[model samples]
Target: MPANNLRRIHSLDGLKLVMVLCIVWWHCMPRVVFGYSLPDLGARCCEVFFLVSGFLEGYRHGLNYKFTFEELWLKAKSKLKRIYPEHAFFLVLSILVGVTSGKEWAVLSDSNVISAICNALLIQAWIPSFAMQFNGLSWFLSSLFFCYLLTPLVAYIALKAKRPVGVWHLLVATMACRVLLEAECAKHPDIYSMVNIHENPLVRLLEYSFAYYLALVYRGRLGADTCSKKVSFLWSVVECVAIGFALYCVVEFNGAWPRWMYTLVFSGVVVIVAGERGILSSLLGCKPMRYLSVYQMQIYISHAVFYSLGWALFPTSSVMAHVSLFVLIVIYCFAVNCLKRIRQNKPKPTVTESFYF
Candidate 1:
């Protein structure tokens, strides 16, 4: 199949879905499921998100001179339009709930309020929570904005730099990055502990960008439209091994592994997930799964709130409550999609738009 005609793999989608679940379980279940207190794997999931974004952005934003100034701005605008809706909706809703509940946890500080204003502008992710106590998902958005701001620069750099001599150079660079980037992290034994989890923002950008470049390699150029089976296979196996090893560390290593190692592992998994041409996910690529994939942003926005509320109402100790809330979230998604369908079938808002929308 032509790459354009080919749907993304259901396995990749399943990977995403499972990653999302791991995120939820890691956040909500505590030590019960994973034998660790907090998985902090949400960071890993965001890396996957970044890899996808980077690949998609790289593919779309190839050879900067090709697009005129107007086209560039329009492209950026379209990206924002897709990303902003759920974020804005949730932030406002979260604020309403916070204000109404008489709790200061969700209340905005003045500086954070400014950041929130910045966030609302879709310029940055903000510090996440107004009070620094909540808004767990903002971390992903934060890193995403960081990557977005640097996309032009990243493109410029990747386009200009020498391509690696071969896969070995890529491997060496990846390892050197792991060692050097984590050097400061390693020295601070106090900080090296599991609780802190070494979430350096710059490091994340580099990590995801590496995966992005691998995707670029798979596409057969530093920055081009075409795909290459040769380079694709190279990135494919490496990503699989790296991510597989990381999963082992997370599960079998008893959380002894450091955050930097996990980042390395995650970068590997993302390659296979993003570059695998939808082979595995293809088997399960029914409409419902595709629909679920479509609502990723919507579900991401709501999942945190639902989990938090579920915890507040049910707590982790209440297994039945947890199950019930999971069901509720499913129902919530179904209703959201149903309503969206209804609106789509409804008449257009403006006659002008109807004629030329």
Candidate 2:
């Protein structure tokens, strides 16, 4: 199928919104829920975000026959422009919150100054000590920016393969490399800090690259065709099984499995959901879910700030405080989205009007 003719995968948007909420819950209170560790489950959810990002990048690359450095630069710039503004806004907000609340971590020391610099440049994730500086969760954006810059090279290599199996081979090799790194980290826990293993661009990039290759494979095999009734039924079953396997890994395996193993499971979930033929897919892609997804990024980026403020204003252990904080975050995100839309839709002045002004 022609890439230009491909339909939008609305279901992925809904999935993203769901993951954003899970991340918020994890950050607010990292605890076991229904036998699953929220912290570990949150890590898996973050992996899914990386996978979704890479898949979209590869899928967009499929729309073109040629790849060039200029195109790569443009894509990187586009992504940075989209993410950096919000990141900077929240970074400043975090600093203010820290100052007002007299948070020790936000104190201005030499190390902290360096951390601020790194965060400003979106390179905090590359520095283990500085990874959780202002707006700690911004480290995800830092790592994601690194992946965006590499998309051109990754896409070129994947496209050069000329076959889905070849791309799969690349993905397998990357996964093997990730597995070895995970083993090394496991062997020397003292040497590798949590930030080093989790927020390292080099480590996270493997997961992103794996999904990029998987996206190419998906395009080659599925090609955006609408499934017939029988095929849709089969796809629905596959989708359910894929989701079930993912849940099993999160619940049953929990922290026992390697990160790559969970990545593979979540990758299957993404592929199955992207098929858009399943009953679950239809339900997830419903209007309400799609509408809520518009604020997914805003919610993810700003929720930490709200949590910080909530801590200052309310008792940390109070259930009502946590609920109130979550609600306030949602309302703030909604307002932000509304303002963005209004700005985007506002009319531009004509040349004569601008000259008069």
Candidate 3:
């Protein structure tokens, strides 16, 4: 599809808000509040974020730009420009807060300095021990950096193929590879023990590849328009079934399903939500949802910073504490966003101001 024909997929922004809110809830809430425990969707939420990211990455490739190295490099650089400044800003603030609080577990210790550097460079996910250091949740950015580096190759392979890499082809191949890796890890327990199982970049890359291939197929088959459409009865039935299965995994299994299972459920939900016109879709596409989506990265990054400080400074044993922290973090995110806009909109230097004295 031509670039102009493609419209921004508003539903995706809504999806991102849902996923990010889940993550925030996971982070801010105590595992067990009073007598009840929170459902375990935190990790699954991360996977959802990865899925959306990979979809957009491939969708952009399909809309414009060649699969050449230069174009890919430019894309990578653009991602860096978008994310690194915010990351660095938060990292510095996190370190400062940790130091000022005199908290023993902050990111500023001598032993943790190396891990902090890894986080700073966005390479922490590659090292198991380093992945969760500093702002632990920030590990997503590190893993995503790895995916970004590999995206060009993945996109090129998909685009060059004679046919869309069938969904089955990608699924079977990914599952086979995962099975082999699992078997090997089983035999050599030390390998798995030495690494963080889920947070590792290699493990997360599976999802990245899955989404990229899926997007390639989607862009080719469905084009760039992902707006809602009336679905036939059978299609609606299938969508409901898929969504039901996904919910079952989350609710009944407490999100203990295998990664592949999670991907299937997320893909189904994403497709249905993005393309099917319904009350839910309308709610997702509303103005408030889309507005928050614009500041998602800021919200995500800022939440980690506040979390670090909150953990250090507050007694978060009660629901009220968690709710208070959540509110403060949201306010902080909005404030930072406003400052960013002010900086962007500041008047540029005049040409005459550059004249030599």
Candidate 4:
């Protein structure tokens, strides 16, 4: 198979930027979504996120999910390179923000430091203290790291009995689990109760597993990329309409819906549509978008720092503050990119033309 199908698609970069936008909105605006709160959406967005991973991994690794432990570890190293530097930067920054704010730095104690040492490894989400208590954006790092860790195994099972059948099974099992869990929670609906479900390792694993598997079955095997521009364009519009309907159904003027999973279902589908290139290729691949998509993760990490500081300095909520956020983050990104480019131009050891690692 041509690697074009397996390689990371340009549109998916756009999809990630969209995910970050959703995250930022959820973080900044809570009342807009009834009384559910911002953190709720932040956590819930994980549902669609992990599913996208399934889709990408399944697509990237091909029909055969089998890989040696070493192979998995090799991939893990590449992931570490991409994620850890930014994580460390923000981890220290978050602590500085908490400490220098003259607030009681409880998470800075000896015991907490010890715990954070382990958490810095980015392995466990089961620990209560580590949950959004320190290094908030580390949530995505830990989640993606965990997803990368399990890709080989997820791929293996997903590739069996033909790809689609396996993926359909995964999807059915996942939705069924969600339905059952929600039905059981219909009575309690307490934050703690929902937290318990969210913390359940099995649930998180299954959710992310389906994400990677979806990418494999649908984007990979379906050859949605091979579709003509016209059909893909039409499908994109339909996906948007479905997304609009889903939003309308869930986001009532009076209050949020009793079950928010409808948004999850709809958003997940809409996101996949966004990832389809021929559908939105021209726009998503445009220069500005390509630029935005490239540095999006950097923007994500840095934006929070600016927003938190801006909030303290301004000490007021206004539309200009939000607008200023976009301007400041763009300036920060450009400056960082320029610095990186200068570094790339620095002197380095010369190598022969035919040299190989």
Best model per TM-score:
2
Could you tell me the C-alpha RMSD of candidate 2 in Å? Answer: 5.7
| Better candidate number, 3 or 4, judged by lDDT | 3
Tens digit per residue, CA lDDT, model 4, 45-144: 5555565555555555655534787788788897887778767776777667666554343345886676567458885355545555555556556656
Superposition-based RMSD of candidate 1 using all C-alpha atoms, in angstroms: 6.7
Checking candidate 2 for backbone clashes, the offending pairs are none
lDDT of 1 by residue, 1-357 (tens): 134533233344545555666677666665555453544576666656555566555444433533346655765676565556656766676566556555465566676577556556653433323313345465566556666656666565666666644533554575577567567566874654431222334655666566556655655533232432333445545655665676667767544665556656665555555544433323324455544565455556567666656556665557766776687578776675666557778532221110000
The better-scoring model by TM-score among 1 and 3 is 3
| Residue 136's lDDT in candidate 2 | 91
Supply the TM-score for candidate 4: 0.76
- The lDDT values for all models are 0.54, 0.78, 0.68, 0.58
Candidate 1 least-lDDT 10 residues: 348-357
All candidates in order of lDDT, best leading: 2, 3, 4, 1
Give the C-alpha miss distance for residue 192 in model 2, angstroms: 5.4
lDDT (Cα, 0-100) at 337 in candidate 3: 59
Candidate 3's residue-wise lDDT over 169-215, tens digit each?
76567656755665576588786765454687777777777777777
In model 4, which runs have C-alpha deviations exceeding 4 angstroms? Answer: 5-8, 29-44, 64-66, 103-107, 162-164, 178-202, 219-221, 224-233, 253-260, 267-285, 312-328, 339-357
Indicate the residue-level lDDT of 52 in model 2: 90
